[model samples]
Target: MRPIGLLTAAALSFLTSVALAAEGKEGMPQLDFKNVLLKSQIVWLVIIFVVLYILLSRWALPKVGAVLEKRAATIAGDLDAARQAKGAADAAVAELTAKTREAHAGAQAEIAGAVDAAKAAAAAQTATLTARLDAQLAEAEGRINAARAAAMGALRQVASDTAGVVVSRLTGVAANAAAVDAAVGSALSARGLG
Candidate 1:
């Protein structure tokens, strides 16, 4: 309750001071149209405003405008430079891409050529081996045939001698070589061995 009374007293004092201050002002000087000093003040305000305007237009404004124009031109030049750089980068990328494609194609062609060469070499080796094997086979067959002919000749002579010996032992007579050869020849032909 004491705090509330103190706050009321402070607010009343503030209000009293504001009222006294307000009562001391006869009126707003700027609104006093009949005062003679108001006209002189207006005249001085116009002269200062005109002087400030002239100074700004002739000196400060022109300098500021030149600075803004220079900044704009620099920005435009930087933008054009960036565009040119981008164009150069794009052209370089295109050139590099073309080179990469060409290199790829060249590598493919080389690979194809290598494959063809390998295939041809393999074919040639196979053909050469086949021909060599055939030649060896033919030679072996010829040797076998020669051995068979020699064995056949020796078997015929042995057969004739055995037959003559058998005939002598059984009949006490020597068989004629020509007659035995003819008999063996007839037997061999009948059995399909001749």
Candidate 2:
């Protein structure tokens, strides 16, 4: 048999022997221990059991429930705080990214503006330089025209004097030298200088 069964049989045998010894002689009454216990008072047992149930339900059970509720609330509050912190971190990251983008845009705008200003300044400088050069060229041309005109006038005066001398000598004509010189001087003076 199983160990539990063997142990139970031994316990039962010992109880039987004790019960038989506790009895009177064989002719006297054989007292039954089971029947004596059953006939004993039962009112006190019911009262004790009821009192223990009332105390556990009213005080002990409520206290245990309150402790469990407090633990649950603490865990939920911690989870909520974690979630809020995560949201705040995400918002901060987003803000930083936006600021970086804005800074890049601003830098690009500044670079473009500087380039435009440089181009405009270069164009303006070129215009100014070209105007100055054009004015110089025009002034130089005017001076050359004046000098050429003066030179041509002097050449004409010399040619006239030479022709007059040749004709007077060939024809044996006595031309007035003073009149010829005066005419040549007048021709030279008409151009702007004597």
Q: Could you tell me which 10 consecutive residues in candidate 1 have the lowest summed lDDT? A: 23-32
lDDT (tens digit, per residue) of candidate 1 on 1-194: 99999999988977876786688954445667999999999999999999999999999999999999999999999999999999999999999999999999999999999999999999999999999999999999999988988887787788888888988899889888899888887887788766
The per-residue C-alpha lDDT of model 1 at residue 23 equals 89
Query: Residue by residue across 1-194, what tens digits does model 2's lDDT show?
Result: 69999999878977777676678422213344355553453566678889989999999999999999999999999999999999999999999999999999999999999999999999999999999999999999999998988887777667667867876998789666777767767866886555
Best by TM-score: 2
Clash-forming residue pairs, model 1: none
Q: Which ranges of candidate 2 are over 4 A from the true structure? A: 1-57, 145-194
The TM-scores of all predictions, comma-separated, are 0.47, 0.49
Clashing pairs for predicted structure model 2, backbone only: none
Quantify all predictions' global Cα lDDT against the true fold: 0.90, 0.82
Let me know the TM-score candidate 2 reaches against the reference structure.
0.49
The numbered model that scores best in lDDT is: 1
lDDT at position 6, candidate 2: 91
